[model samples]
Target chain A: MKATVHVTLKPGVLDPQGQTIQRASEAIGFARIADVRQGKFFEVELSDDGDLEAARAELERFARDVLANPVIEDYRVEFLSDLPAASEQE
Target chain B: MKATVHVTLKPGVLDPQGQTIQRASEAIGFARIADVRQGKFFEVELSDDGDLEAARAELERFARDVLANPVIEDYRVEFLSDLPAASEQE
Candidate 1:
């Protein structure tokens, strides 16, 4: 199973990179871009250990402890079984 | 409408950050991680302009020209209509 984690800054946090992108987009003649926020996307490949529930919990902890900095960033993990769509459940 | 762009390095490209994360995971006692790949995720918020098809085309070009390094990276643009599900049909 593959776990995909998206780590994004919480709203109200300043994102300089996103600001640069917003300005860059405008400079490049693209319009209607109200805002842009950048983040980290990670695809973690794990050998199937069968217990998805346990794996999900483990991955969540891993994501929290290692992948994202909980103080300013938030992360969401989605499980993609066998490389197909990782049925993202909110 | 909001367009999401995920820019990922093409296969065969070296990802040192991912390698670091993989090593760190192992050192931290996290197991079953066969591989880990990292990428950039961008959320571009655009004010509605009505033509979804045209917007998609524009966003596609924007992604290709700006967000991705065609030499070594690949990007996919997903349109999220009205902040809900971006009806990612591909």
Candidate 2:
């Protein structure tokens, strides 16, 4: 199975990178843009035999312990379809 | 409208950050993880009156021209529902 994780800064936290993107858009005449927030995205591939519930729990632990800084960022994990990942054979 | 953009490295591209994450997971006992790829995520808010089709086109252009490096990265844009962005009132 495959899953995606997104780690985004909390609303009140400062994000210079996000501001940079917002400014860049304005510089290029994208006046319609009100805001641009940037974050980290991850795609994780799991073994076919991995226990679904265990993997889910472990993945959440991984996300909190390593993938995200809980003090400043929030994370969400979304499971993808069960299709074999293209990179599995590599 | 709110939309999301994901910028990921194309297959065969070297991803040092992804490697770092993968290694970290292994070191931390996440044996279920077969591989991990890290990418960039963004949340973009457009003005309410913004043209839908035009915004879609502009967003794609913005993603390609500003958010992603076409030579090694691929980007996908997904529009969210029409709910007003929280930051819009700020």
Query: Which numbered prediction scores highest in lDDT against the true structure?
Result: 2
Tens-place lDDT digits, model 2, residues A3-87:
9999999999988988898888899888777789999999998776745677777778888888999999999987887434433
lDDT of each: 0.83, 0.84
Any residue pairs clashing in model 1, and if so which? B79-B86, B80-B86
Model 2 alpha-carbon drift over 4 Å, by segment: A82-90, B82-90
DockQ of candidate 2 compared with the true complex:
0.67
* TM-score of candidate 2 relative to the true fold: 0.86
Q: What's candidate 1's DockQ score?
A: 0.74
lDDT at position A71, candidate 1: 99
Error of 1 at B28 (Å): 1.0
TM-score of chain A of 1: 0.83
